[model samples]
Target: MEFRRLIRGRVDEPQLERIGREIAKRYDRESVRISVLEADNWLSTPCVVDEEWFVKVISPQNALVQALFTGARNLGVFSRGEEGFFERFEDPLAMSQHELEATRRVREIGLNAPEPIEAFGVDEFGVLVLEYLPEFRTLDELPSTEVEALASELFSALTLMHANNLAHGDLRGENVLVHGGELYFIDATNVRKDGLSTARAYDIACAIATLEPALGANCTVDLAAEHYDAATLLAARDFLDLVRLRPDHEFEATRLKGEIERRAD
Candidate 1:
């Protein structure tokens, strides 16, 4: 779709009050308060629910939401019969449920993800409630050392996810939030628990591409080369090849394959 961020800003008090009321009524919960979380989210505005959970709000009638859903369908990410598929804008509950399940599965694999609570409704809008991360920072604001440390941790996390046959299809920097030394991955809607091997490679590539702008490409590449094995590195290189063809082409993959085989030897 468009390589652009969705609009994000303040949600007025009346609307926030309405959202809180909706959550309480839909989920049969009480004393739920809503406040905007850290800014700059693409599709939805995540708000804190009480002090224990977060809720991502998406209005069904919003043009941006429609455009995003349309883009998702166009990308074949939301097929008709899929587990998370929704045919109408008024049906984000399914998509929100899928996102919850994706995070739950990733956590089951021993990765970091907030515990998913429930998806609730407020009029024509949907809200995904999740466990709170009391102290978390986005990837964009980290220092060099933190970036390198995160780079290595990200590789480890990605390797573990791939080994478990899962791929975070949208592995961008913004999707990763850090607290202390722990990395909590948000926006799990696109995570593929039964993804193809190529999809896994793309996951790696997306991580690399997202990190390159913050940390230099060469530095990120070197860290990746050091963090992962030859096979994974070769796969990453294959992804780079897709983005921009190298003159070495066949030789690059072949050479990396040879190295892997030599290690076996």
Candidate 2:
């Protein structure tokens, strides 16, 4: 937790005030209420604005952390005998711009994502604005039964993204928000087109890893099987352990691996 804080960093009150002012000016609001969310995210300082806009104040530190995570994920891909495919951003605004574009891409392909308002620079921070879902729960926050019920929808969304050649490089459970009874993806990282296949497999690995915790290894593998063939499952299986290394993920990778092998058989 401390390490996460170290990397995630904090936006001081003054910086938040500046961000709020910028947001207010951009939307022609006299003033906006800003409330920082208590989320276990490492990439941005997320907050709600005027109870309407879901905003991310991306700091240079957040961009650096993203670059580090991208590097590490690429190294993991290399372990699978492939070159790295994840792209790195040089600044905070670049990160914000990428997310804005990614969200638009997802929405363009008829998937759920927050309505992207805009991405702009405000001093040292890059701010991204989107429509806020006042009530929602992340995938990891749901009960086992509810999570199981959403299994098909979850995999289907992933399938749509992969089929459209849009790879969600980061598909962690937290990034999958259940809002108004629908799943909305967020925080999609940039990936190279040449690495799309590897990125797709890694996305599937994260999807399976995410479900196994809530639905258990057996059900999770079965759900994956319905959407993906045995070969793809085998490919995703190779990345399971690597996904497990992340601090946010807590699942029995060995059991998941066994289940995937059984499905392949």
Best by TM-score: 2
Global lDDT of each candidate: 0.63, 0.89
What are the per-residue Cα lDDT tens digits for candidate 1 across 1-265? 1332334334567777898887777668974777786655555677887777778876543435545644653344323222332223336455566677778878999999988887766665567888888878877668867877778888888888877766675566668889868899886534334444666665666666666666665566666667666676566555543422311112233333344344433
Which ten-residue region of model 1 has the weakest summed lDDT? 243-252
Residue-pair clashes per prediction, in order, are: 0, 0
**How do the residues 100-136 of candidate 2 rate in per-residue lDDT, one tens digit apiece?**
9999999999989989999999898999999898788
Per-model TM-score, in order, reads 0.71, 0.97
Pull out the clashing pairs in model 1: none
